[model samples]
Target: MKYMYWLLIFIPITLVARFGLQLNDGLVFLFCCFGIVPLAAVLGDSTEQISLYTGPKIGGFLNATMGNVPELLICGFAVQAGMYSLVLASLAGSILGNILLVMGMSIFIGGLKYKFLPFNKNITHNNFTLLGFAAFSIVVPFFFKYSGGGGITEHSLSNFSLALAVIMIVLYLLGLIFSLITHRDIFDDEDEDEDGEKEAPEWSFKKSLSVMIGATVCVAVMSEILVHTVEGAAEQFGLGEAFIGIILIPLLGNVAEHASAIMMAVKGKLNISIEIAVGSSMQIAMFVTPLMVILSALLGNTMEYVYTPMELLGIIISIVIAATVFMDHKVNWLEGAELIAAYIILGGAFLVFGIG
Candidate 1:
């Protein structure tokens, strides 16, 4: 009953958004962008519970899928509306959301509780390969655009993008198989059941998977509305579609992610903190964006993955600061504060509407 209350709340929002989209396309997108906050907040709390019982790989996969719930739904709806630019901005926003806004706020809030924490080094190592893939992926859109390739059409960028997506999706499947079956080392979370609040409930593979999917659906539906509402909200604030997405959409999504970071941070789980920040960024960059590309192609929409100069620099700076900070495998409250400051400065600069 209690869980159903959440489902109830979300379902209505989704419906309302659907109606809004029918009425005004701009408003629907606004609503979709706003959907991420509560979803993130809830998932951050629930994920720990699920992660403890189900173990990390499943948890990580769950997190990867659920963490992206908003993006997925918004993209789905956006594709139907032919708002390709909005979709693209949201993609870029998510990476920034995870790296700076989520990570920064998480550290600050978590530092208030505890100064530092420990986390898995091995997790950090594996994440690098994904991050590298993401970094490369981030650059691809730019290369395609200026490479004199008609900005995404000349090289049959769609064909190329689809092929690239095939490779990535294959990689995702291989990674999943490797973790869950072939070599289970990646998912074996030995430290899952920490914080002995309640007796750990046994989760069948079926139950965990079901809840994961259900939660994801709720997130997606809500997020689609969020995107819809964003259009209206942008009008209200007199903002650009890109500004709303690149700035606000990601920040709202960070609500859930920020909580995850803070929790890990307060536990002084710096490695997990960094991983959540960096890993989620990688997922957005490599996994989510590519998946969206493939979906766009199949849906008969042209989805381009180009990044603005601002986006490129943001990714580079975000990775450098984050990696440099986490390299020593330790964190202080001061360091956490520094990260938050950096984000503030960057965000302030980006807010200049005419600067672009």
Candidate 2:
């Protein structure tokens, strides 16, 4: 992790190039891109350090929420920029990347060393149910838009999205209470420190909180610059903004969390790895997506929930595949390969066929 922090030097360089020298948007965009990754990792580590003091239940909630700060800020900035398509595509990409790319890598690499990986069946079941419902909620707007026979007004669609966003957020909060409070016993697994050696926190609570705050602020600055220059950057690369949002931005924002999941899996902690991947995806759908809908309105952009058919299809397929793979709460290398293959094929389709 210390080695990764060396990339932090790019943060200042990004600021200087963008604000001082006024470099090309493409170059500045790339610098901000690299800079945001290390900042996100720092934020994650700090969150982990703080978690050590909070106990598992509250700590788990903190990790789930803070873990997504990078992508949340990025998408928030994009929405503020009125790049609705890019933000929508990014939301879809995030769910796909987490469940498929990150989870697949974790399982595939871990499965090679272990015959079978098993996690908590109860937790997996609840997560998939929540994810499936969230997917269904988001797509309702898409169907509503198309099913209106060209008579649906943009204002009506926006109102309907706003209503659904409110309902999803309400349900998302209830879900937290359900799993973390009312039904926590069902979700909690037995403590497994058989060696009787608990890990210690390296940073003081004050230090962890301070560092998390600073890292988030820096990420926000970088995200703003990244979104500000996205168009120029896309034109320079000859790539559509939708493609960049779907593929590049999601990977860049959450790369740190992705690495953490894969590392946990390699250490034979499939339960933790799956939680990081699947839990984050659920938070994005239930929490972040709706939050963005409200933020878009506040930003005066009025972003709607309606997505392109391909984006909606990709999300639904990703969730379905994830649910199927984890149905039995056990996975092998072949299942991992299948998930990765699914992601690659989906990505290829987006590239070759275009998002719209």
Candidate 3:
């Protein structure tokens, strides 16, 4: 985790490349991508620190809201720029990356030490049930488009997206209530370790808030620069923005979660690792997607809920496979390998098929 802060060097490098030397867009894009990763890590860490000062319930809410701030900022900027496909692809990629790539790596690393990793079955089951519903919601607009047989108008799709976004936001809020309030015991049980050593924040509250705010502002600026370079970067690499979104952007935005989950798993805190993976995915599907939809609409560059058929199919299939993997409430290294293999195949498909 400390090593990630070394990436802070890229922040100055990106600025100098973009404005000082006026480097090529591809280089600027690459630098900004590296720059954002550590900023995101700092943002997440500071949020965790702040959560220590707040009580558990409020801390949970704070984590839930701040977990995806970097991704949301990037997508928000993309939405403003009318890069709808890029935003949508990034959202889908975040979901797949979390459930498959992050969780798979966590399980594989943890399973290497322990033959099997088990988590709270009932809690995991409930999380998956909500995840399944979220997946279904994501696919509905795609289904609506095709099922309409070319009769659906853009206006109607926008309207549908708006309405559905409202419903999703409501449901997501209800879910927060469910997990954090009425059933807090199930979700909050892992805050402490088996030996009952609950870690305390290392930074002062003022320092945490100041660092979080600073990181967020830096991420916002970097995201703007990053989005500005997407087209040139795509052209330079002979790739599509969708490919960049599907592969690169999510990785940049989620470096913190990816690192934290794997570290937790390695330490035999597999439950915390899975929670980070699955919970992050759920937040992307329910909270981030809907918030983006509504914000895009309000900003007059509306991003519909509709997705490319291939992209939608990949998300649904990933969710199903992930859910099935956890159904037995146990996982082994081989299962983790399978999940990683699936992600690789899907990524290759997105590359070959185009505009995922």
Candidate 4:
């Protein structure tokens, strides 16, 4: 966290690019992208600190809600700008990155020290069940779009998307109740040493609150600036918006969670590592995507849950691979390698095809 402070220099640089020097859109986009990383780190840290004062259940809720703030903010701005494709791509990218890039790296690094690591099978099953539900929700909308029997008007699609969004949100809430209340014990880390005392937070509650607010505001501002420049930047760099959304934006937004997952894995805390990766993906699918649908409508952009065939294919492949790897409750380095390889192949395909 201390080292992340150095990256704060990019904040001023981004501001200068935006208002002072009036740099090119591509350059401003680059600066804002880098600037958002450290702010995200601060946001995570502040959330953790604030959670210390709230108790486990509420704290877990807060952490889950704030985990993807940067991505959410960026997507919100993108929605406002009517970059519907980019928003949807970023949504898919976030889920894929967590399930593949983050989870795979954690398993691979953790496997380097241990030949085989086993986690809670019950939790794994629950996660995959939720993931399956999420996949179904997303797939239905695409089915609606393509199988409408004839031409589908924008109003009809928007209405269908809103209906699905409401259902998804309800399902997500049910999941929260199931996991956090009735089945809480299933997700608990059994390996945690009961006798080990917890350390006190360094920051006071007020300080944590202040930092969270400040970081969130800064992230929002940066995200707006970053999204506004995305089109110009994409054209300037000979890159497609899909490429930036699927690869770059997701990576930038989840950098903090990615680092934490890897660190937990390296420390042999594979349970926490798995939770962070899988849980983040579940959040994106269940909460963020649906919320974005509603938000986009309110913003007058009215994005549907429909996805291009390639994007849908990528998501389905990712879900299937993740389910297979974690189904046995055991993981090895080779399994991790397989996940990373799959992600790379999908990324390459997206890069080449520039899939909407």
Clashing pairs in model 4, backbone N/Cα/C closer than 3 A:
none
Question: What tens-digit string does per-residue lDDT give for candidate 3 at 236-345?
Answer: 98887677888788878777777767766776766667667777788888888889899998998667898788778888888888888887888888888888888898
Which of 1 and 2 is the better model by lDDT? 2
TM-score of each: 0.79, 0.95, 0.93, 0.93
Q: CA lDDT, every prediction? A: 0.64, 0.83, 0.81, 0.83
Where model 3 places Cα greater than 4 Å from the true spot, the runs are 50-67, 188-194
Question: What digit string (tens of lDDT, one per residue) describes model 2 on residues 289-322?
Answer: 9999999877766788988888888899999998
Clashing pairs in 3: none
How far residue 71's Cα lies from its native spot in candidate 3, in Å, is 1.2
- TM-score-wise, the better of 2 and 3 is 2
**Model 1 per-residue lDDT at 232:** 71
RMSD of each: 4.3, 1.7, 2.2, 2.0
Q: Could you arrange the candidates by TM-score from highest to lowest?
A: 2, 4, 3, 1
Worst 10 residues of 2 by lDDT: 189-198
Model 4: residues with Cα > 4 Å off, grouped in runs? 49-64, 193-200
